[model samples]
Target: MPARVFVALMVTDSGALTAAELAQTLRVSPAAVSGAVRYLTRLHLVIREREPGSRRDIFRVRDEAWQDALANRDALLAQYSGSFAEGVSVVGRETPAGRRLTEAMEFFEFLRKELDGLMDRWRAHRDAPRPDGPPA
Candidate 1:
């Protein structure tokens, strides 16, 4: 499936769509939709849920899913930063490699901080209600 089609399905307000529906909307084959759904599921970006009283599965984005993805990213950055910081220590700060390692670690650290902040904001916005809606 194309990225745009995948995105369209995921971003829908209903939170779920069938492969057939997605294929129709995207003007693509069911095989393409299936492929995209499989890929998205592998990435943990989309979930498949069986509908009640039916075998047909719907693809949906989980609530707090983006927050979880952000957390995973933060974990990766933190791990990389820790390892690179240690490398910087071993290389000696006065050397070019050491300086480069330090810079890389610093960048990852900063990115981790940014991801943390972004996750917080995402949660806040997600939990907040629209002006016309009830309390979140």
Candidate 2:
């Protein structure tokens, strides 16, 4: 599965893996790795690159992978909220179903608003000087 491969790659000392390496590490077929990589690449969760002077492609997680992934969710949240708002309009705002949709819309809008602040806090925490030493 793509999630499994992502976890494996995340724990690896090297941030990148070739298709063959991923297949071997995951104990899956090369086709499985290919499919997973394709999905991950499309999601911007992983990047596909060619090794210099080699035919093999390397899949790598960017240093800001988590941040990038969270950022990408903003668009999805906006879309969902918009859909819910539309549903409220169609169902009549006074109706029970419309009330539920309004609640959902409000919740997602809150998240959309708060996500950036949360990310900013995370960045500050991540970049903060540690008494233990520099981040690994």
The lowest-lDDT stretch of 10 consecutive residues in candidate 2 is 57-66
After superposing all C-alphas onto the true structure, candidate 1 shows an RMSD in angstroms of 3.1
Could you tell me the TM-score of candidate 1? 0.71
lDDT of candidate model 2 versus the reference: 0.90
lDDT, candidate 1, 19-85, per-residue tens? 8889888888999888888887766778899988999998887666666766878778989999998
TM-score of predicted structure 2: 0.94
User: In model 1, which residue pairs have backbone atoms overlapping below 3 Å?
Assistant: none
lDDT of 2 by residue, 28-116 (tens): 99889889988988788999889989998888887688889998899999999999999999998889999999999999999999999
Global lDDT scores for all candidate models = 0.81, 0.90
lDDT of 1: 0.81
Q: Which stretches of candidate 1 lie over 4 Å from their true place?
A: 10-13, 86-90, 121-136
